[model samples]
Target: MNYILSIMPSLFAGAKMTLILFFWTLITAIPLGIIVSLGLLSYFKPLRLVLKFYIWIMRGTPLLLQLIFIFYGLPIVGIIFQRYDAALFAFILNYTAYFAEIFRGGFQSIPIGQYESARVLRLNYWQTLTHIIIPQVSKIVIPSIGNEVINLVKDTSLVYVIGLGELLRAGNVATARDVTLIPLVIVGIIYLLMTGIASFLLKKIERNFAKWK
Candidate 1:
């Protein structure tokens, strides 16, 4: 018990860093994804091409490689970010591409008749999107979005590569110092709890959306 208590501070601090990365990335990614998805669907041919290429690049690359490139390689050309910032940037950029794809799929799933109906009702694009399209898309993509959110929780551990002392790193330190697997076990439990909480909240939101539908 005393050993566990003594280790709490380091673990908590690491968890805090992990949670911060997860929150900011999620907050930024989803909204930016919406814009990118709209670009994918745009009638402006050049814009669509550009967005498609951008999405392809982000989706094609491994996120760990992107993190390394952003943190290490970019400094060669004088683009530098702090370790945390680099991780956050990489996460947001990568997840935004994925979420954009998800949103694009949701947008495509909407029936063409709905758009024509909106036109018949004299609804402008913005009005149609805000009033009708968004609500349905929100519900349609909830499961996919929930999966990403849970993945983000686990992905936070990847920040350890950049020497940021996130949860898993903290556990590694304790395990190495104490020469016991208890710390690693605790770390796994923490991770499970984090994902479990995320799952619960996402399911509740999904149920609420189902009610709306």
Candidate 2:
């Protein structure tokens, strides 16, 4: 329809922003999550406690509130970042906490016997973790990680509150001008398509990893 055609560009622009936010959040959050999970699993009492507390705080607060605080409040503390960057930072931190918890659960699911067997084989802690633990944990964590990736895709719309000019923001701008509601519909379709593609890829990854188990 002509209505759909008119708003296609704005919708696509929003889609681009959405993809940027989702991809970067996953790219940064996954490794950070692994580090935090490792910290919580450490033998050091203080380190474990600190990492646990960090995860609890991030998981406990609302993501939107966290975003606002990072963008609006951090400037008072001389830690200013641009709106998009601030949103990215907040999303990464928030998602890291969540992914860390998922990774921790995956790690815990591995049996104690495996660690003992690794020790008997003369494998050091690092080698045992890299070879024995990580492989198994990757399987358990893959499904959870996949779910979080999908969530991150949807959460991209939330960045609009920070003036990120993402898909939802573009729709809002279109709405204000009394244009056809086609823009909003197109935004939804874009998200649905993006999520579908992501879901397909993650499912493939899961299957590939599942084979090792």
Candidate 3:
């Protein structure tokens, strides 16, 4: 018990970094995704094509490669981000593509008649979106978004590849030094707790949205 207690400080520090990356990535990515998804649905052929290409690149490639490219490869082209910045940028960009597709599907699922009805009600574009469209989309995309949010909890570990210490990295370091997997077991438990809490919150959000249906 004392041995485990001794490692808590380092482990908590690593977990703090992981949580920061997870949160800022989502806060930035979700709005960017809403924008990108709208771009994907835009009438302009050029804009659609460009955004499509961007989405294809982001979604088709592994995030680890994206991280390496943004941090390590971009320096060749005069673009450089600090380690944490690179991780945040890559995660936001990658997850934006996914969330864009999810939002696009949600937007498309909303019937056209509703728009016409909103029009008949003299609701302007912003009004319709605010009062009607967004609420429905919020409900529709919750499950998919929940999945990604949970994945982000695990994905935080990937930042270690860029030499940013996170929970997994801290655990690995302690394991190597102590010649035991105890640290790893602790890391696994922390991850499980994080995901479990996320899942519970998502369920609550889903239930709240279900009232709309």
Candidate 4:
């Protein structure tokens, strides 16, 4: 217990970085995903094909590889990014592809009649989307989005690959230095607590959306 307490500050600092990555990725990626999904659904065949290829590349590759490529490989081509920026850029691009697919699925699941009705009522494209389509799509994709968000929590640890010490990395350093697994155990517990809170909040959001059904 004393050992755990001794390392709490370091672990907390690492966890703060992890949360920063997670929150900022969510803020940026969700909207990017939406825009990508809209592009995928666009009438322009060339644009749709390009976006589709982008999504395929992102989704098909390992995120760790992507992280390394963005951070290390890009510098070879004269594109340099700081470690944090590299991690964030890779995470947002990778997760945006995933979220784009999820949102695309949600958009397709909507009945055609709703769109026709919106058209008949003379709702402009933006109004129809904001007032009708988006609400229903949000409700439908909540569970999938929540799952992705939880995965994002875990994935933040990958930032350590670029030497940006996040929670798991901090624990790893402590374990190596102290020659004990206690720090790792503590880190796991903290992760569980964070995920538990996220799950609970997601359930609340789900319930609120359920009222719309």
Candidate 5:
């Protein structure tokens, strides 16, 4: 109990870093993913092929390797980043690919007849997307996006591979110092709390969108 109390500050600090990574990654990745999805669906064959290959590479590789490459490999080529920056960069890029694919799937799932109907109603491309396409895609993608959000929470721990002092790293430090697993147990609880809150919020959003169905 005393040891747990003693380690609380470090654990909290580490958790703060973890949250920072998670939020920024999600905030930035979603918009970038949307753009990538657009590129994937574009009429330009070269652009579509390139975007598809990029998504394939990102999804095929482990994020840890991507983090290592961004943090270490980039420095070798004279493009250096701070630890946090490198981790954030890798995370956003990696998750953007995943989210782009998710969004693309959602977009494709919409029937062609919907677009035809929108055209018959004289809606411009932007209006059609804003009024008809996006709402439906949002509904289709919410559950998948929720799962990805939860995965992002766990994936933040991988930042430790790059020597960033995120939540799992804090637990590891305490465990090594005290030779006990209590810190790890506490860290697990913290993760569960974080994911639980996210799940609750996502469920509410899902419910709100459910009205559209």
Candidate 6:
């Protein structure tokens, strides 16, 4: 217990970076995912194929590989970013592909009859999508989206591989320096707290959506 207190500060400092990485990735990925979802739904065959390939490539590869490529591979082309930013860029790109697929699946689950009904009412594509499609899709995908959010919180630790010093890395450093396992425990607690808060908010959203059914 005393050792736990000693490692708290180091764990907390790393957790801050973890939180920042998680939050920004969520913010950037959600909108980008929506856009990618739209592209996948596009009527143009060529555009659809191109986007499909892009998504496939991103989704098929491990995120760690993507991070290594962005951080190290890009430097060969003179696109050097700080380690943190490089990690952030890789995370956003990787997660955007995943979230886009989630959104696409939700959109596909919508009944074709709904689109027909909206068309009968003379609603345009954008209007129908915004009012009719997006709302239903959001509700349908909420659980899955929440899962991704939880995963994102844990994945923030992966950035430490790129030298971001996020929570897991901080815990390792502390453990090495202080010769205590408490730092790892502290890291676990911090992750639990963040995941707990996210779960609470997602549950609230679930409740709100449930009201419609």
Winner by lDDT? 5
Local accuracy of candidate 5 as per-residue lDDT tens digits, 1-213: 788899999999999999999999999999899889989999999999999898988999999999999999999999999999999999999999999999999999999999999999999999999889988998999999999999999999999999999999999999999999999999999999999999999999999997766
- CA deviation > 4 Å runs, candidate 4: none
lDDT against the true structure, per candidate, is: 0.94, 0.88, 0.94, 0.94, 0.95, 0.89
User: All predictions: root-mean-square deviation over Cα?
Assistant: 1.1, 1.4, 0.8, 0.8, 1.1, 1.4
Q: Model 6 residue 210 lDDT?
A: 88
> Which model, 3 or 5, shows the larger lDDT?
5
Tens-digit per-residue lDDT, 126-192, candidate 2: 9998898988998888888988888899888888888888888988888778666767777788888
Give the poorly placed runs of model 6, Cα more than 4 Å off.
1-3
**Clash totals for all candidate models:** 0, 0, 0, 0, 0, 0
Q: TM-score for each prediction? A: 0.97, 0.94, 0.98, 0.98, 0.96, 0.94
Cα lDDT tens digits, model 6, 46-151, are 9899888988888898888888899989999999999988988998988899999999999999999999999999999999999999999999999999999999
lDDT of 4 by residue, 118-189 (tens): 999999999999999999999999999999999999999988889998999999999999999899999999
| Candidate 5 vs. true structure, TM-score | 0.96
**Of candidates 6 and 3, the better by lDDT:** 3
Off by over 4 Å in 1: none
Range of the 10 consecutive residues with the lowest summed lDDT in candidate 6: 1-10
Where does candidate 4 have its weakest 10-residue lDDT segment?
204-213
Which pairs of residues collide in model 1? none
Which of the predicted structures, 2 or 3, would earn the higher lDDT when compared with the native? 3
Residue 144, model 2, lDDT: 84
